[model samples]
Target: MQTISSCVEAIVLEQPFLEEALSKGIINYSALADVLQDDVSQTLGKPVKAGAIMMALRRYKDRLTVSKPYYGLNALLEQLGDITLRSNLSDFTFRNSNTLIDSQAAILNTIKNKSHIFYTFTRGILESNIIISSSEKEAVLESFKNENCIALKENLSAISLVLPKHNTKVAGLYYQILKRLAWQNVSLYEVISTTNEFTIVVEDTFVDSAFSIIKNLNKN
Candidate 1:
């Protein structure tokens, strides 16, 4: 049931850079097809002609370029609201376990009185990530002492954005913002976002540059 076209799409989609290059029509389709012929043939359990793969690549490129309209996305970027930075943040990751919630709850309960403290949690299937003020590093470690610590990083800062209302209705909003940051070579440790709030965490050194890049993303 796996056709050459489907295989080509699956392979290209796995690599975002390739998909982007193809969308911009920067890649040589025939050359790419030749490169992909082996993978495609192997995936299909048979040999496929490079010309056939090339045709499939062309069709996929057409769809990718046509479907990624950024008209609404542009307007959304132009409407970004206040930008703020929080320094001296620490990042922690722990494997998910039944008691992970209890450990997180303890941290929150302890920080509740400190209205100025910054804290956020993102729970994944395999692990949970916690970002908190570095001042509270000891507290977090003690609370999560029993948990399996996967990683811990300090000397980082977070830059958060206040997005315009109805930002979710626009397509590729995050991609546009992140693309600009990527162009400037800003290294992002993590990206966190809510419906109307977007935040990026980077090392202390990159915060100012990242802030500047995002603040002027809409300017001509």
Candidate 2:
């Protein structure tokens, strides 16, 4: 039989948003008990009352709050540069092939002069997904026209946030930035992560909103 304490722990662990709310003391215990009573009983294969669940929640409240404070997070945010927006972007995906391997140098040389370029080479067991992004659509098309391209997507835009180098060991920094964007219903076409910076590519229409959403991460 699963104890109430163990079940509460499992619930908090599985639900990140709920864990955050509980840690921040913003979660209504009565509502949480009401919501989880059925699930807990089903999991335990018995009838568990809401009052018992609430008591268990209170007993494990401290254990449920497990958020770690990232030191120097504010200092790193202060060093963030202004958001840079680029338009008229294009994304190209090429199938994995020997020809694709030989064509990489030519394609890179073609877009080397563009204002901005994002290149990702993802290899799978059977194939690969090669993504190349640049502002020069015509040049990109011209370079890859003869290659074995499995897909091509265009009319994309990029919003890059240049952050200062923070401790990589610190947790939840990326989560904080991504969670804010998610809450605003911003869809990311792609994300390029680095040691000190993170860039997200979105459609031209959402560029303004995405930038605003990311910039607000520093406020809290």
Measured over all alpha carbons after superposition, the RMSD of each candidate to the real structure, in angstroms, is 3.5, 2.9
What candidate 2 gets wrong by more than 4 Å, as runs, is: 64-67, 70-82, 115-135, 146-148
Model 1 C-alpha lDDT per residue in residues 88-119, reported as the tens digit of each score: 99999999999999999999999999999999
Residue pairs that clash (backbone atoms under 3 angstroms), model 1: none
Any idea what lDDT model 1 has? 0.91
Instruction: Return the TM-score for each candidate structure.
Output: 0.75, 0.82
lDDT of each: 0.91, 0.72
Model 2 TM-score, 2 decimals: 0.82
Write model 2 residue lDDT over 1-220, tens digit each, in one string.
6798799779877877777777678878899999999889988889999999888887666664443454466566666776777666666666666666656667678767764576655565555454555445566567556766666666777777777655375667777777778778888887877777677888777888898888777787
Clashes of 1: 0
**Residue 85 miss distance in model 1 (angstroms):** 1.5
Q: How accurate is candidate 2 locally (lDDT)?
A: 0.72
